[model samples]
Target: MTTAAITEETKAGDANGATAREGRGDLLDQVSASPRPRVSASSSPSPSSPPRAEEIAVRVVGLVKRYADGTEANRGIDLEVGRGEIVSILGANGAGKTTFLRQLTTELRPTAGRVEVFGVDADREPRRAKGMMGVAPQEAGLFESLTVREHFELFARLKGLAKREARAAAAEVMCGLDLVREARRRVGALSGGQRRRILVGLALLGRPPLLVLDEPTTGLDPDSRRAVWQVIRRAVAAGATAILSTHYMEEAERLSDRVAVIAGGRLAAIGTLEELFARLDKTYRVTWRDEFGAERSNLFGTFAEARAFVARESLSEFSIARVSLEDVYFALAGRRLTDAGGAAGGTNVTGAAGAAGETRKEGAR
Candidate 1:
């Protein structure tokens, strides 16, 4: 299938680019900081778009991280997450997503670029940065030395809660996470889901304004997954802003106010689901049975502009519907979302083009 026929991802194909060339030799975390020039706001900020005026919770501007081993992880990607919004960082492996997450939480300092968490320069004021944010990594980071109550106690202390207040805060967290029953259980003995719950519980201890989760449900069963979603919703209701990196498309769809699709360490698209779909021209799906006992389905950009087509062709099997986020993902990426058919590092980024080819190739079979 032609790339355009399958996905709606637009790119200016130069797959092999300068960033990829520079970041070829460092350890995963040791990737060199991006060497790109910085981004400048207009002397007069655009009040119409009002990016600066808006209470943006997280702003990533021209982020580039190039490892010393010559592996470039991020390449001039720009992103903005508004206050109280849930944004999804959607990408395949090595898409610079984890790096983005690390930088925001002050876990990995950016080699270059500015990360403003709650309107502060994080690099210049890391303590201030860490103080206002909560992080739930893919792997839980609780201490094996502590019991559930102790784990909560430790995190509350980290948030600067006094002894009595910390205890009170811990109690609230345990109640919110439905972990009161396991308050005395050692964290080391908790199951994976329980562990994730604690991770989230730790982040929510102080009702932080910003919450960052790195694949918060990596090993969870369906039920546990829903349980975590509940916790996230409660956090948002408490006026928190969240940015989560996830490969699970369904999770992204359900939790995100907008989704940012990243490829080759650059953003392919960023918008609400409907806004992204609008990038596609309206189209129709036509299906019918052939004389040879086969079913044929095809997509068209137009319905032959017929007023009576729907009435005339009462084919019950064919229904009019809008494309889903999955369809939009396929259209933009030019491949099946589930078609991860390669080795451990097998992913969809095929080149280092400064910019990928910028055409949504109409791909229909």
Candidate 2:
């Protein structure tokens, strides 16, 4: 969408005053209620399964975003997400993950390229595109004075549900997000973790066909994080598509059907965990402390090789195992997992190089 067009829409929405949120809410309800092609399990296979003919939930072509100050947040990025799939985006703090998502959510306009949500042009028909999506931004305001139940009910009603239906929907979402115990408490009285769960619950309302979550479990504890994962898995199992960005490697590895790594304002790599792991020649890793107590790690092509090296080194404190998702991420992102949100320079061995190679292979085919 053009900047001027977005500005005009914002102005119009503001002009509507208190009714604007309600209007948008109603639009969501209408969109969710409309009949569309169903995504069968056979048609929309999971990442672990073979590909089949399925609807595309999201498509981006040569997407780019350049700020007024000349900072390029996204550059010539292209991606496609299948219906009912969960695609996790991983990147450093300034790597443009949020910028990519905001464009998909129509909250930000791209400087170049196209974004389509469920076949609707996101740039040209943002409202129609958004009607099919539920978004939980990294940060958003909440009504502190309102109770949790009130927040859900009010938002549900706005989404086009009748009073009773809204109530039931709110209750269901609360249960799924493990917020039922706090339903009667004011949002202001809740803990940060509780509030974060509420934000995630808000997106699950009405079971929207698509969900865009940015650090949805950021403040939650381990148990709460797992609950949110369950909620996401349940939604996808019921044929919902999700695109989320998270810092947790476990979250990305466990929940995502595929992973996308972004670096320096560009997509560095995109593939399933197995597909990504296949790119590495050294599939086994061994870690140990040297005789002087310094830590060391070695990679080998096979487990036997790693074990043989361990014996040859007479390593007493050491571990040998197959490479993990974190290894793949480090390889592709060219940085340690902990350094994910750090400064923008690393090995440059993965990401851009890997993605370019994949692009070349596709072109050749």
Candidate 3:
């Protein structure tokens, strides 16, 4: 499908950019020393109209990342994320999801292309650009010697909060993530899920205008995962834009205003779930075990068509279900979201809005 056809742009007004003198490793340290910058403003009002460049929270054009060994992790990706929206990047492991995020956060410099965060050139002014965002990497080291409350308060302070403000922000974040009870517990003493929550909490500390999270809920249980989801929703609700990369189909389906699929180090498809679903010709999926007990699957436009096929094949064991985001990934990326192998090329389905129109749900702005 043409990327332009599925890509959604929401215009925003304007946001002030900051200037800092530190690198990624010293981001927090610099924040602690420098004054906090003002948060970015609101998003565009209408989806149908074109947005001004300033309305976009994140703008990436021709973004490319090549390692020293000549490995191209990202290849000319272009995307625009509006303010006050949550966009999820989905892909199989090593499909360049993290690579794309790293470049966006200025953690890794792109070999080519430009990145703008709230109208600031991240590549040229990494510190200033980073000041407008809060990031949660796929893996981050925490202070094991510090208590949970200490971690939050200290990070909040590092984000330019005053001692009193830092304490209050810490309390609010802990309470929101259900980590209040573990407030006094040492980081090394907490469970893995609890530690994960702490990482998310750190990003939410200063309520930065933009959040860049890499699998924020990877190791959490159902309840804890939902807690993080709520926290994200609250952040967006309060006017912050979020961009996250996740392996969970449900997370992408439920949390994102727009879902982007990365395959072979490139954006393969992107749109609302309905927009992506409409790209497919069939609405139902049929799966069954064959004579050798191996599984087989097919898509059908109607239930009757699927049933008829089963009867014709004389298959005794089969099941039919509705097509979902997972199917969309496979159809557009030519592989499952969980696959580790390279993409094999995509199905014939291309472009958006094929058939599923009535079921389309307007994404929350």
Candidate 4:
């Protein structure tokens, strides 16, 4: 997708840009020694038409990250997320999902490309850009000595809340994350899932306009995971735009407005779930047990075609279903969703180029 360039009139330091950066650092510092966290006025807003560059919450152009060991984790990635939209980045284990998020959060500096958050250049002013966002890294160190409530309250204060506001915010977060019952318990005594919840709660303290979460529910039980999802939904309902990386297809399908598939350090495809599903010709799926009792599956353009294939194969037991996001993922990445390792070269079946080519062909026709 092409992102319109930010006009000089909207570049940082302009009157409007200054308003965007205002209170990002000063307001919080005024309340305490803690740096002020900047938040956009609203994470989610109803826009009747396409958003302009200045309206984007995050913009990444030609982003590239190369490590000292000569490993390139990202390559020429271009993405734009509008205010109030939930965008999910999906990929195999080493397909650069974390790398992309880290750069967006300013946790890791990119070797090349430009990143802008809320109109501020992240590369030149990471701290200022970060003030506009709440980030929950994949792994973070929590103080075991702090109680759950203490952790939330303290972090709220650190995010620039006053004493009374901090307490109220902590209470709200605890209730939202279902950590109220464990509020007074020390972090060290909490289970892994509980600690994970605390980490997520910390990021939500001030209801920052943007939330960048890297697998926020990784270790939680199903119930806890659902609770977290509710918290995220509530945040979005209140106008928070969220970007997250998740292994759970259900999470992506349910939570995201758009899904981005990354492969070989590049964005393989990005669109709504329906748009991605449309990329595949085989929209029908057939599954059956072979003579050896092993499961076998195939895809066809239609249910009738799939049924006919089963009949031709003399399969007695088979099921036909609509295509799912997993099929789109496998088609794009040329591997199952659960597969690990880097994007294997020449293995992508439906990458960005292929998708673009398909679009061009349709337009030509």
Candidate 5:
């Protein structure tokens, strides 16, 4: 589809008045009374025994994307998202997160792969696959002249809701995303953050079984981010599945049932936080400053080793804490979550998390 046409199709939607906590009848119920698809297993099964087609909300195998310039944006990517689950994709710029999602959404054709959504072959039947999904691309435009309510109602109708049903869905989304107060305001008058929320609300219009959000919380402040999180959680609770890509570590840590780390155009690791942490030999991290005052960090196999190193070094300013998803990302992607810089504050230890019970001196490998 042309850019203009795509925008018109997805441009308009709702925004919450204050927060999703506004207590309007459960947004899900007001939007769709039908039951959400459910999987017999709560999560995707091990790769050795993949979940049945019906139990899978989304499935991709050997997904590859190559541009005409000979750049392979996505290479051999494979993933499975179970129904009623939330999966977060993490990666730095150019890591192919967007490329991967675009292929899944069928906006970009893959060089080689199979993508299925709820048992439908997306590669073969893009329309049928898209009908079962609510997609919020990383970037989409909203109509400047349209009011918030108009955006929501019109999009709901376009998604096949009747006039009355569209109006109800619009109101529910407006209140749920804190856009009620701006119901009549033109999209041109809204702030960027508010505009972003409106885009999110658009995806929630018909309550499609799958929600694909690419950095839905990109520009919002903390509270707004949390509000969006709540909205997504409610949607999932009501039986929708969500797959989102985000740069925020905390978002991935708190919002996802499973996290997939995309590095160098491939999926480097995929698992729960605990499962990822267990992959690290160094479970504890110590942060301190060298005599030169440059920040230094070291990973240890155990808390005892971390504490001992601090005491042995006669350090008065130091902290020892459990490694986090940030560490995991560093281990897998070789970059920090906050920026496209080398891992935070020192030599990257994700690959070599210090020898067991050994404390290396500052900058010493």
Candidate 6:
């Protein structure tokens, strides 16, 4: 839909003059009554074992989200997060990735279907459902007036960690986020990368069984981004399940066990990178311009398959290439992930305004 035709569903008040929070009741009732799918986290690792329903930590069945302005942000999406799995949702801007995540965490009510986290309905029991979740939004959500310790303190409190225990947890998290030295410094005074790291740290503060991070590394220098990757891996290793939303295909390729491509609010594809590529039937395109003035290109399933073909065909001046996740992103979204949001979201995650709040609101990754 065009911008002129869209009304913001995120506006301040509800249609009834009550706060929008009250409007959630009807959605909550539907969510509360829906059937739940469960999956166990500690089942045996047999390769041939089929995934059991009880082993799923998060499930979205026929999930749909439509904005008040008639824009459907999620068009009948079905997704599952196994115990301890990192499932990445990849898309370009306006592709409905974040909107879908918002549904999983109950920040946005689904217009149809349900979201279940650890056997609890997010729509019906949002608070109880959230207790099992830790969400790190793309935008830096830290309060400028609060120090690193205070930031984690707020999260720990929300997660039900006690005061003295919360302080200890905050210190440990600050150390991991590389903000130990700034624990006492006001968040407003920290550098951009520092704040981003701290936001990640806060998400981990609760030690929730399920973690949902929206654009966890949108902004930051290469080093800071790498640091976040390390932290995420650690989180997964500890048996916590995670859902990552990101525009960076490389990040998703490296971290996710499975990924779903969203386009214009629809789920275009869902599977492992290899599985989706296989389903798309996209082949490795080997291209070469020969001395004989002929342009040669070929498709192969495996690098070995391509190599054998090259030798058999005696294609001397050939280059072998495979479809990249970035390629898949474009084929599904109709635009480059990096280009849709632009490099600006990464470099000026705080956006151009640079007022601390503006900067904080600029980027989430």
Candidate 5 stretches greater than 4 Å from native: 1-50, 291-294, 338-347, 350-365
Q: How well is each residue in 303-365 modelled by candidate 1, as lDDT tens digits?
A: 452213434544444433323455455445544343323233232322221121112222232
* Model 6 lDDT tens row, 129-189: 9888888877645688987778888779878999988988898777666778898999889
Worst 10 residues of 2 by lDDT: 2-11
Better of 2 and 5 by lDDT: 5
Residue 33 lDDT (model 5): 30
Tens-place lDDT digits, model 4, residues 1-365: 32212111111111222222232223222322321122211212212233587679888999999999999999888888888788888888878889999999898999999999888999899988888888888889899998999999988988889999999999999998888999989999989999888888888888988899998888889788877777776787778888999888767776677888887788888776555655665555566655656555666665567667766767667666655567667676555444446233323333232211111011111
**TM-score to native of every candidate shown:** 0.70, 0.77, 0.79, 0.79, 0.80, 0.70
Best by the TM-score measure:
5
Model 2 scores a C-alpha lDDT of 0.72
Candidate 5 local lDDT, residue 238: 86
lDDT of 6: 0.66
Which is better, 5 or 6, measured by TM-score? Answer: 5
Candidate closest to the true structure, highest lDDT: 5
Which stretches of candidate 2 lie above 4 Å from their native place? 1-54, 290-295, 338-365
What is the per-residue lDDT of model 2 for residues 205-315, given as tens digits with 9 covering 90 to 100?
888899999988887898888788878877887889999999887677767778888877788787775555555555555655545555445656655776676667665
* lDDT of candidates 1 onward, in order: 0.64, 0.72, 0.74, 0.71, 0.75, 0.66
